[model samples]
Target: MVRAGFLLSIFLSMALVPASARASDPDPWFGHDKFLHFSVSNGLAAGGYAVSSLFWEGRTERLIAGGSFSLALGAAKELYDMTGRGDPSWRDFTWDVIGTATGLALAWGIDELFFRSDARKPVEAAATPGGLAIRW
Candidate 1:
């Protein structure tokens, strides 16, 4: 996740700011490119971190795993935009990671709120779906 975030950050903050999306716009953020950049970066980072936390600690290995996933997701998103009518840019990748990182924080906060007492499990685990059960 960290690696992905880093790559996305670079793509958005540097790669696309002055190049791509010159005549394009993002849906959620509208014409605000900065918003897109941060959103993507945090989203990808957080998502990767969340997935890794499912099977590993938030250590180096876990972080790396998350980063790798983030990178792949970022690539996929770019590819999606490329094939679609949307404008694809490196900056978009940056925003994805920012969004991912934000998601990670959100996930951690949720775990703390719903499963602070439960170790090595998701916050909501009725075994229904979203996360781990609280009672096991």
Candidate 2:
């Protein structure tokens, strides 16, 4: 009987503790965090796009890969923040998405404006007796 009563009291206390610990005030630095999230996501997206462009021939493929990487990184950070120290905010995620899009657009614009003409044209591959040969 004593053990049962003790366990019941412990459960009641655990439930009530969280209710009292809830804060009534808003965070002071909420706006700054959104900007930080945007800048970090933007830089990450631009870097991902730049590196992927070096390996991918198709523009659509490179954009998709870069965007996916950037969004995944943001999601990972948000999930990590949810553990204890920080709460996940959808507003910050919205900024991250916007920043990633901006970064991708910038990368595409730079590539199209400056590097398009510098690329070597691809040559058609010819099928030979033993294998296919490609000329650039």
Candidate 3:
């Protein structure tokens, strides 16, 4: 039940982000914000995976699924941007992948760092307290 709800929420939220954006088309990009975006997205992806795989027990599989989903979703988003309502920026897609990876790393690092005193320390861990023994 919990896992279903989280999956539904994340997928739906992604769909909702640009219902109309998909109708149009996006242009390309010039500047770059790779590390920052990748890091944030990585953290977010990890957290998102934790939530979606609440019923699962294995950590490796959950991470792989999460990573696969993130990559596919990022590519899909880029495709949508090109065909539908976003810009045709392959660069952005690349960054999206990078970000997702970074976000996952950050989430893990945070968990390892501050998962003791306050569960809220790790952004990703905070998002999904499934395996965490967070006091709060």
Candidate with top TM-score is 2
lDDT of 3 by residue, 6-87 (tens): 9999999998888756753333343544454455467668876666556555545656766776777777766787886956
Give the better candidate number (1 or 3) by TM-score: 3
Residue pairs in steric clash, candidate 2?
none
TM-score for candidate 2, residues paired by index: 0.63
Question: Looking at candidate 3, what is the lDDT of residue 60?
Answer: 57
Q: Which 10 consecutive positions of candidate 1 have the poorest summed lDDT?
A: 116-125
Ranking by TM-score: 2, 3, 1
Off by over 4 Å in 1: 1-34, 97-136
Worst 10 residues of 2 by lDDT: 24-33
Each candidate's lDDT (Cα)?
A: 0.66, 0.82, 0.64
**What digit string (tens of lDDT, one per residue) describes model 2 on residues 28-128?**
33578878888888888888888998899777787887789899999988888799868787777888898899888887888777777435557667867
Report residue 68 deviation for candidate 3 (angstroms).
2.2
